[model samples]
Target: MQFTFALFAAAALLTPVYSNEITPMSRRETGIKLESCTTSQQAVVEAAVQRAASLAKAAADAAINGDASIFEDGKVTYNCGNGTTQSDCGGNGVLAYALSGNNKIVNCPSWYKIVPAIDDCGGTDQGLAMVHELSHMNEVYSPPTQDFAYKYNDLVQLPTEQAVLNADTYNLYAGAIDLGCQVGESKGVVLPDWMVTEIMNNNSK
Candidate 1:
């Protein structure tokens, strides 16, 4: 009996034990890495990333699932600093940006807002900004086009094909889901019928 017990103990000791620490679903699925951020900044980023993931998942559960699938969730490193002497963030009122085909997201100094619980449709916040950058990742869309509009007003007027390819369209769709409001109701801008239908379908679900 003692030999049997010793054998069991030896076997248990030799078994490999795995860690219980589980990575967040958002970080795991999106491959988002936060670098060189303060504690508060990290908190803001975490919230925004979580919100963006939630928005993406919600969109995936609707008729616009194809749009949500475009995110790709590729590896992206986010930094809280002015990009290379403020080249992208200097004077154009840009909040955050990712260079075409780049795996990095640089947040301009002005991009310090926390993810807001949007109360109205057509409103933008940090989470939407993250969504925009995710769309710009090369893994998500190659040869990212900069000609498409990012502003809500202009986005509503873009052709359906062009709008689908624009980063801001994802932002707006995600934003609308976050707010639980329809884009047309808030801005009085008539989006393409397909977009309106998709938004309504998402909201209804």
Candidate 2:
């Protein structure tokens, strides 16, 4: 249940963002790269990487392309599509899971580029989408699909699964809060009520 949404989801919210602080990711090697996109979009991605530094670094090390000793081993590449229908960004972001490895790509869709969309509970659609996909790049949960991020969804909390679920919940809410707060400041849009509620609920916990 990876909830998919367009750029419109990262909505404007001036609320208190984080209630539950995210434990910092134990950083890893920067084995990831970005292959396509304009210089401007590339800059946007650089900013995104800086904002999500730990997750980005984790994504890098999680890839073991060929032999561990090889320089190009386990390298993951992301291409910023032009937010078109026929894009690798696959409606904001795409996570590919394979027998060999997993790949994540995000389309850098600007706030203005998105058509006027009605926000429901998804003010941080693009931001959350990006975070969700990047989080999956770590492969800690080993969910069958690359898209199954446990956000507002149930995960069976068996003893073996409880720890993973707890971690997932933290990351999901932390990113949600981050994206929610940034939306209003950067995107200049009003946060949907649902988004505010969601943020408040998470913060309360």
Candidate 3:
């Protein structure tokens, strides 16, 4: 149920020009390494990782003076493989995953898009999905937990304590900032500025 937006030009005009108040994290800073993926896939991975890092940085800046406490060190290796053979592939609509103890590695399916479009707040793209995976890495969240609040609906209703830990919360927060809109706008569950403010407020408390 992925929604595609063919409004890149319109989106570009709507996308905010993020300031340099806090330097955004780069792919190198994130330490994301791709294996067994095509050159085009690698490029998409790079973009996705960079996007996640920048969004994470933005969240940190807005929440706690650019303190990226969860992103301790972005050292994760991504391996592309067939969905059928890989564990956690295509389960419950999951796009990627990090094994329990081997949190340094993320398994992505071969069918994973090389260049997924920028998602509206209602839907997810590869970039947003990768952000969800990043949140599971030990380097991102120490003692990485398995309880990720999935989908837009769960993200909005998440309690403060759970919202701070849920991977999808981070994804939606990033998406909210990237799209400059409320979460679930397309799904008709609009909460004005909820994603941007709620998580930051929770972190502040």
Which digits, one per residue and each the tens of the lDDT, describe model 3 over residues 75-176? 456765423343456554556776635654454563264346464555677766666666666544543434546777766686665665666766665566
Candidate 1 per-residue lDDT over residues 90-154, each given as its tens digit: 56567787864557888876567433556556667887777777667665445443448967788
Candidate 2, residue 165: the lDDT equals: 30
Q: Assess candidate 1 and give its TM-score to the true structure.
A: 0.71
User: For model 2, what is the alpha-carbon lDDT of residue 72?
Assistant: 33
Model 3, stretches more than 4 Å misplaced? Answer: 1-29, 68-74, 82-92, 143-145, 183-189, 192-205
Please identify which of the two predictions, 1 or 2, would achieve the higher TM-score against the true structure. Answer: 1
User: Model 2 over residues 103-178: C-alpha lDDT tens digits?
Assistant: 5454544422532222332233333344444434433223322323343433222232342333333334444444
Lowest lDDT 10-residue stretch of candidate 3 = 1-10
lDDT of each: 0.57, 0.35, 0.52
Candidate 2 runs further than 4 Å off? 1-30, 54-74, 82-102, 108-127, 138-171, 176-205
Model 3 vs. true fold: TM: 0.67
Model 2: worst 10 consecutive residues (lDDT sum): 7-16
